[model samples]
Target: MKYAVLIGDGMADYPIEKLGGKTILQAARTPAMDYIAAHGKAGYAKTIPEGFHPGSDVANMSILGYDPAVYYSGRAPLEAASMGVTLAPDDVAFRCNLVTIEHGRIKDYSAGHISSEEAKILIETLDAELGTDELSFYPGVSYRHLMVARKNLGAETECTPPHDITGKKIDKYLPRGKDGAFFSDRIKASMIVLELHPVNLKRIEEGKNPANSIWVWGQGHAPKFTPFQELYGKTGAVISAVDLLKGIGVYAGLDVIEVEGATGYLDTNYEGKVNAAIEALKTKDLVFIHVEAPDEAGHEGSIDKKLKAVEDFDSRIVAPILKHAQTSDEPFTILILPDHPTPISVKTHTQDPIPFAIYRTDNKESDEVQTFDEDSVKKGSLGLVKASDLIGMLVKAK
Candidate 1:
């Protein structure tokens, strides 16, 4: 049997009054997703375990069948793995984001989604100036970057994610706890280094948000993961534009498929991702396709964009893959869900049970759910299942 998992990252949302009190999923036209819910099984899955933060790293790890309480070390280490930056036992990898600070307040988390080309230059410059044997910076994609500190410089430090503090004063949210002052110092140093840099000047000239500072958080050492094949008895591949998902696949021993033009934004190449998944299924038993646009839109609190993203995902990604699975000779099981809820109202990740749908070509038995949305799936036959256990159900584990 073949398997496909489609993740619309942070796609779930609370009802928006502007959208007529309907959630983005309910407002968007998602016939493909609805078809799966109508023809198969649908329910809610608690992707984030109790006492865990509602971060994508933990949620996706759970979806991929690894209990976060067991395998999750930190978000940055996963991104580091995807970037091919091996972490030593004593090294702590941090997720470094190029951010925009205005008037001592956190203005933007993503620095207006600064171009990777521009970010690379800024990252290299930071490494040149601030990097020493104990601290180093590595560029990944866009505003997302990495900093590896030797001897766990800030392993115990508590730093808030920049996205969570948008529009808030930086002083209250600055890194705290052990060695947090060290991270705060670097953040201040970055503001000085980047405020007048060529890239920031150019961006300012163009009426764009300047990446004027670096925010470091999500630090941890490397984590050990059992190969996907060893755990599930199936070879798999993962396709995503974000480094974190790719890193998870790297550690899980899944093929990390890189598609041209696949950005982790609304402009990402959806066609290329679907095509890659179809091709990967030729050799692999399962393929995981993740799209980040919905999550980005949720972060921006743009209802229209989130609606467009959800509709595009339904039409461009899900429809094509589902058509292929239906036409293929081999039986295929396809699962669709979000890693976590980046609610439009909250504008951040929330520990909510996300709705999921699973369709099988072999067995057409379905549940009461006829649509794919937060509320519609509650009546599904599958009911509520643990995110980590979904894989076992998909693989029909004995």
Candidate 2:
């Protein structure tokens, strides 16, 4: 059986033009997605669980058949993996971010969109000056980066993520350690010095992002995954809008291919991504397409942008897949789901269950439904689901 899966970001709600901005799903015209819900089965599924701050790495891993409970570290090590950074057993890692704090408030949280070249230079400089047996800086996407190998150094360190968009100060995250006062102070002090370095100021003047603030958090290590060759007897491939997702795919032994002119931004090759998935289906047994525009737009608090992303994904990917399924005689089954609910209000992925659905000839009688989304799916049979259960459902359908 051929399986096609489309993983959207956040499929949550927001105030439409009635308030100020357009709800992401409402703003765009998703004729294709509309066709899927109309012709195929549509329902809501809890892709994430409560209490856990759901992010892309854990959520997608759970959805892709791997039990996240068994294998979940943090996003930092995945970033390190994507960049080919090796991790030893004693090494500790954290997701590092570049932030601009103005008067104790985050002015430019993403370090003004730091590029690879600028980060590489700054990383090299930091390594030259602060580089030691215990200290290291690994560059990642924009403000979200990684720092590793702090063993035998100290403990009681916390990370200040500039995640809170309009908060008074950055949030501190420390997984676990023995000392609180001693190690925390040293890490805080070192980061403060990095924030005020003269080298970063030069970056600001050059119209590039400043590596002013180093907000390092997300304490986690490596996670093991069961290879698809062993589990499903076929190789798997992955495509994602985020580096961490790509990193996880690489770790799980998947072939990573470019979507062709993908910018990893809003309005990023929407139809192109779907077409790329379709093409990959011919060669690869399993394919994953991740879209981040919805989550980014939600965080940006741009309702129109978020809605457009959802609508476009439906039209460009959902509708086309439905049409193809009607004609193709291959073993085809389609699954559409979101990692978590990134409400426009919080602009982050909540543990809330996002929408989901399955369409196939085998379950056509058992899975007849219409109108997808959270509210509409509640009226149907598919109830709340754990992150680990999605793969089983796919297997059963096949």
Candidate 3:
């Protein structure tokens, strides 16, 4: 049986008053998702484990059937894997973000989603000036970049995610604890180098948020993961625009498929991802398709954009995949859900359980849930399950 896992990243949300007290899932048009819920099993999954931050790295790891407590490392090492940056045993990887700071406040976490080209130039410049024998930087997608520190510097430091502290003062949130000074010093140095650079100057001229400083967080040493095929006995592929997801796929021994125009934003190429997934299923037993647009809109606290993202994901990604499974001769089991809740009210991730639906073409069993939404799925027969068990369920579905 073929398996498909569709993740609408950060698609879950709290009720918004602007949308008549309905969550984005409830307010948006998601016929394809609703159809899956109606014909199959709909329920909630605890994607975030207790005492763990609700980060995508942790959540997606769980969804991929690896317990975060056992195999999970920091977010950057995963991205480093995707970027082909090899990490030594004692080295730590950090997620380096180009952000906008205004009047001593964390103004924009993404620096207005700076283009990959401009970000590449800025990161390369930072590496030239600030990189030492102990520390180095590598550019990735958009404002997201990487910094590898030898000898495990700042591995035990407490650093805040820039998105978690948007618009807040950066003083209290700066890295603190063992070797924290090493990271904080470079962050300050980056501002001096980037603030007056030509890239920032050109961005400011265009009335856009300038990539003025680097915020480093999500640090860890490399992790060990059992290959997906060895663990589940199935060949698989992962398709996503985000480095974190691709990095996870890399560690899991899955094929990472890249699509043209697959930006981790609202303008990401939806059709391209869908096409890639369908093609992958021809040779692979399982395929994971992740969309980052909804989560990006959630972080920006844009209700209309999140609604559009949700609707677009359903119509563009889910509908086409479902159609392919129905028309194909081989039987298919499709699992649909989000990694976590980037609530519009909080503008950050919450550890709340996310709703999920599993539909099987070979065995079409109807559930009581008529639609796919937070409240509607509460009554599903599947009830609350562990996210780490989702892949097993999909694989075992008959």
Candidate 4:
């Protein structure tokens, strides 16, 4: 038997008035997702535990069957794992983002989705100038980067995610608490270097958002986890474009499959990811496929783009995987869901239970749910299951 867990990151949303008071999922044409709900079991899953921020690191960890409370050390450490940045016992990792600040306000978290090629040069320059014996910078995909601080410097400082502070002032959001001054000074110094760099100048010429500064947050020590195969007895692989998901796969002892042109945005290669998952499942017992485009659309607070992202995910990514699974000789169980709700109104992640659907090749039993939206899935049989239970359920499915 084979298992596949598909995640449309931040795909859940609140009802938008522009879409006739329908959520993006309801407004979008998601035939493949709707079919799963119509023919399989659908319900809500609490991916975000109480008292935890609804970040992808914590949410995806839960979705992959690990308890965040037990295993989540920090977001950067996970990305560090993906970047092959080894962390010592006392080493702390920070998520360093090349962000855009305008008139003291946080304008864009992704700095207009700066290309990795451009971002690499910027981060390397920051490391050479600002890096000390205690702190250093490592570049990852696009806007997501990393800073490792040895001896636990600034590990306890309170920092805010740049994406969460979009359109808000940076004064109150700057890193605070112990070692806050250290992080704040470095972050401020980054602007001087970045603002004058040729990269930012070129970006300005192109009318793109310049990565004028660095915002470091999500700090913690390394984490430990029980390997996926050891815990579930299933050899698995993970397919994603973002470092966080790939890092989670690394800690969980799963193969991380990278696809060309797999950007973590609307233009991401959906076909490549779909094909990767199908190929992985041919030899691996489980595959976790994640798409980040919907989340990016939600963060930008664009209802139309969010609709397009969801529809594209349904038609392009989900449909092909399901088709391949159906034609294969081995039986399969597929589970689909989002990490959390990045509501269009708020333009940030919320701690909301997301709708999910589970389909089995052999069993066609389903509930009254005919669609795969937040409201429609409330009628499903598996009401309000914990995210950690999802893997076990999928593995045990008949």
Model 3 pairs in collision: none
Candidate 1 residue 128 Cα shift, in angstroms, is: 0.4
lDDT of 2 by residue, 1-398 (tens): 66777877776665455545644554456666555565556666655555445677678777777666667766677777776788776566767666666665556656665665666666565566655777687765545666775662322344434554534554334222553343344345545666656667777678765656555565566666777567656566777656677777777787776675454556577777777777887888777777876766766666667777787677766777777766777757778877777777776567766667677755554344456665555555566677567656776553
The C-alpha TM-scores of every prediction are: 0.99, 0.84, 0.99, 0.99
Error of 1 at 6 (Å): 0.2
Per-residue lDDT of candidate 3, residues 283-363 (tens digit)? 999999999999999999899899999999999999999999898899988899999999988889999999999998988
- Poorest 10 consecutive residues by lDDT, candidate 3: 389-398
Return the TM-score for candidate 1, rounded to 2 decimals: 0.99
> What are the lDDT figures for the candidates, one per model?
0.94, 0.65, 0.94, 0.92
- For model 2, which pairs clash? 2-331, 24-306, 24-307, 25-307, 32-319, 33-314, 96-145
Off by over 4 Å in 4: none
